[model samples]
Structure formats: C-alpha cells, structure tokens
Target: MPTPSEPVDEFDATSSTAADPVLPAGYSMRLLDWADLPAVHALENRLFPLDAWPLSFFEEELAQAVPEPDGGTRDYRVITGPVPGSASGTTATGTAVTGTAVTGTAVIDADRDAGAGEAADVVLGYCGLMCVPPLADVQTIAVAPEAEGHGLGTAMLLWMVAEAARRRATDLLLEVRADNPRAQRLYERHGFEHIHTRAGYYPGDASAQGAGGGRVDALIMRRRLVG
Candidate 1:
C-alpha cells in the first residue's frame, strides 16, 4: 500500500470529478444520457487532450447500458449545474457547455430537458464505472476545472466506491497519472493501494495539448471492498 505520507507526484493535478452532497451549492449529479455526450466529449479533449477518448468510445459504452460480464454491470454519471453565485454559475476556470459543439444522442432520456440549453444544465463534471463482480474497472472520472478544490472529488470517489460495492465488486481498479498527486491523495484517503506504476502509460506530448503519444507514467491503484 502506498502511504498517504508518501510524497505526491511532482506534476500538476490534471484530471478532475466531484460529488453531490459535498459539491458546492447549486450542483447536482445524475446518470449521463446520450444528450450529454457532446458536452462531455468536448470537455474530455480539453481536460485530457493526450488521452482523450474518441467519441465512438462513449457511443459504444452508451450503446449497452447493462454489460453483464457473467458478473457485474456498467455505470456513467455526470454533474450538472454551476457553482452558485459565480459568474456563469461555475468555477472561475469553468468553461461553458453548449449543445452546438457535438452531435447525436445515443438514448432519448425523457427526464432530461431537450431544450434546457447550457445554462440550465451546465455540466461541472462526470464519471464512468464498470463493475464485473470481483473485478471492477473505474473507466474514468473528471471534474471541471472550475469545480476543483471543492469537495466534488471526494464526493464522486465515494460514490464510485459505493456503486462498485453495490454491484458486488470486491475490488475497484483505476489508473492515475504519476503527476496528479491530489488525485492520488484522494484515492489514498479512501484506502486505495498503489499496486503498480506503469511506465510511459500516458502517451502524449507532455508539453502540448491534444498531441500524440509521449512518455508519462501511470499509477495503478486498487481498493478492496466488502462486496
């Protein structure tokens, strides 16, 4: 187990995600629908240019909501609304989410407002999880730049842990950038053990955004649950 006291990574915390109860005022979270793909995809490129997932990745995941691996299932969620009382109702670093950016919706969700526009449904963050019984993979979790420093990260992680447990996942797995010390701290707080360091795992030019393959390490973390 990597101790919390261990030195954190030397690089800046790049990725982000957050929770509801711990979120700032005016924040909310719900299952992500096809409508949110455009917004989230844009954010993904911006937030993780090097490792950005292709639009098809989300499409494929959304295609099958119930991925029965002869074991568990899958889950994807997003946080809506902006930070209260702030300009644009989001954190200072928050970027506006507009429907004009991406195209297509995988599933028609009646509960979501089709005409809500970006303001009414400003997205602050999102997360993805896969629970395959004894083995669960945390596909991804991201908090908007504006939503960082708030309790959103902790809240989102806690939610994942609980959700994985609920789906009978005895172990939760995720990979964190070697530079993201803040995220590592958060995971460590939740009893995640750093089991391995994958050399050159993050392949993208470290100096440029949206550039192709470069060398950056990744820390594989795991947590045991009572499921």
Candidate 2:
C-alpha cells in the first residue's frame, strides 16, 4: 500500500493537463478552529505515521493565530468534503464518535448527544502556516486517502498563497521529502522553487518497519509573492 504520509498531488500523471488544479465539486475550505484539533490529530496520525505531531502542538498552533490587525502570526485551515447521508461511519461529529473535550469557539468532550440533527462536516484534509511578518512557513499539509485526487492539496496551497498575500507576507516556504517527487511537482506548479535541502531531516519510520526510524533529506522550496 502506498504510504498515506505524503499528500496526493496527482491522479493520472500521463493524462492530466490542467495548469492549476481545482477541488472536486462540493468540496470547501474553512478556518480550522481549536475544536477541530482532535480530529486533525487523528487524520495526521493516519497520514503521517512517523511524523505525527503531538496534540499539544496543535493547541499551541491554534493559540498562536492572532487577528490580522494584531499582526497575525499564525493561521490554520481545513478542507471538508460532502458525504452521502446514507453513509454510516465515523466523522468529526457523529454517533460513531466517542467522547471529547472543549476547545475555543467549538465544543468537544467525551460522548455527546447523537448530534440531534446537527449539521457536521467531513474533514478531508488540513493545512497550517506560521508567519513572521514578511515571511510565512508552511507548517503542515495532509489529505485523507479517500479524499485524494480531488485537488484538495492544490486548493489548500492556493488558499495559503492568497492568505500570505492577505497577511502582507512577501514570501512563503516549505519542506518536501526528497523521496516525494509527486509533492515536489505539486509545489513547483505553485511557483515554489527549490532553494536548498536539509540532509537527514525527515526521521520517519516509513522507511523502517517499527524500529527507530531513520532519516530522509528534505528539499526546501520558496515562493516569492508579488506586491
């Protein structure tokens, strides 16, 4: 099985011709609030086995996002996809979900009502960034296995580009695993150019079965935004 650790940036390499990718019909992006951290962590662990981030890290990330008027220092966004009403399965907010805890601007805690006709979203993927005035760094990006090939990853990157512009950032940067040419291609398509590489950067067990994971080089890329 292909590792879900990397984002799905391509569906058919040989026949795809669109210069810019677009999300499938019905998909949408929204600000990912603190309430969504638990769901984000679950999906992160699934997509990035060796590189899963701690729950506390996401909490910190959310706490860091300030309003643009306050010189916005961080931002997080999530992509949601529509699901058939008949599909009975787990969701961020569903009976299939167990207990939870409370987070800012959202409710979470262990075992809640059956949602009582509450409208919920199916989290397809998420992305985050950290900004320091003129520059912004791509903190993370991931897509669910079932949600790939629908342009969610591309859509997220494009959204971030606009976000950087909105925040008055001059450039955006990210690191892609050396083994992930698919992701590199996707980044290149978005105007990110190879800046350099960090040797032995990604210490993921994906290359190792269960033992202490080794490391892989990371290609650093940057995109300069036009004023």
Candidate 3:
C-alpha cells in the first residue's frame, strides 16, 4: 500500500485529470479541508437526518486523511458549485470563486476570496474512503438534493473506486440503506454486488413515521478492485 507521501502512478494527488472525472460545467471537486466541515455537517443532517454523523466524526476522519509515521488511511473529497440562482457561478455578492484541488496537507480558506457579504461556494457533494491495503471502505457519500441528477454521485463513486485501487486495495466495501434503491442501483451500475444484509441497520426518522418511517435494513455491497 502506498502511504500519503508515496505517489501512486495511476492517481497523482496534484494532477486534476488523474482519476478525477470531468464534472459538470461550473462545478469542481477538491480535497476536503477543515474549513469545509461546517457546510459538510449541515448537509449531512439534511441528507441523512435519521443517521447523520456528528461534526466530530468528520473532524476525526479528516485528521486521518494525512497519515503520520504510523500510517494514516483515509481519502475525502468535496464538490462545490455556485449557489442556485446565482449568476455564472458567482455568489450572491457577485463574487466568482472556484475551488482548487488541494493535497491532504493543504488548507483551504473558504472565505479567503469572499467579502463579508459574500457567501462561500456551496458544497454540492462529498465522499470519503478508508483504505488499509487489502481492504477499503466507502465511509460516506452524499449529494445535495439540489445537485442530484447531474451525475455528481457517479463522479464521486468513481473517485472512490480509483482511489482504492491506487492504494492497492483488493476490494472496496460500502453499506447502503435497503430502502434507498436509487443509491443501490447506482452502486450496482458501478459493479458493486450485494454481499450481506444487516437488519435494522439504520434508525428511522421519527418525523417521517407517518409516511412509513421505521428502522431500515442495510445492504452491504462490495466491488473488486484487484484480484
């Protein structure tokens, strides 16, 4: 397995085209930075209210993206785009900003380019991977509601697959709610196979109980990256 300091021939951290999908116009993907936590946490609650991860979970994950001498084992990425209804990828304050890809050790100041009145670029999607040589896991992945249907999810999933392969992981694993057939299909289309099922793996949204909300089973899936 290649450490963070080691370069993987197939996926260069600094190369925009290496293992990165061409995103929709006006949208960009980059390494997840500390400054992105607030937006990521908020989006987590909105997207998975029933089992949203706390802010601390994300903080801990980001810390692992940069391995120490003992070894760190994680990769995370975030996709950003203009605020909806904003003009030409500019924020409400009419300031245009683009997210530049950064390495694990890089720091991005989300507000550096914006004036006091300007809003930071919107995080449209985010995904994470945890790799330890032979095995890699898709820690989390989500696309904002407004950003769905534009292939952002597919793009992120591809990044996970490529990153795991580059890290010499033989297989990649992830769990999805059984009720979320849409996501299941996306994984399936990307060559993931259903391998196991965990009963009642996800807590139900009490607020949505009137519409058939209850504990949901989790479908464990895996994709082979190398033999």
Error of 1 at 145 (Å): 0.5
Off by over 4 Å in 1: 1-23, 67-72, 88-91, 94-119, 204-214
Query: What are the lDDT figures for the candidates, one per model?
Result: 0.62, 0.62, 0.68
Best by TM-score: 3
**lDDT top scorer:** 3
Cα lDDT tens digits, model 2, 1-227, are 21233233322223311122355655667778878888788866655655568899898888888775675688888877553232334333311100011101112221231232224457767888777758888888876554555567777776666666656678988888876767777778768999988888776555473676567778888998764
Task: For residue 189, give model 2's deviation from the true position in Å.
Answer: 0.9
lDDT of 1: 0.62
Ranking by lDDT: 3, 2, 1
For model 1, the run of ten residues with the poorest summed lDDT: 96-105
Clashing pairs in 2: 99-110, 99-111, 100-109, 100-110, 101-108, 101-109
* Deviation from native of the Cα of residue 111 in model 2, angstroms: 19
Better of 1 and 2 by lDDT: 2
Model 2 spans with C-alpha error above 4 angstroms: 1-23, 83-120, 206-213
User: What TM-score number comes out for model 3?
Assistant: 0.75
- By summed lDDT, the worst window of 10 consecutive residues in model 2 runs over 95-104
RMSD of each: 10.4, 10.4, 9.5
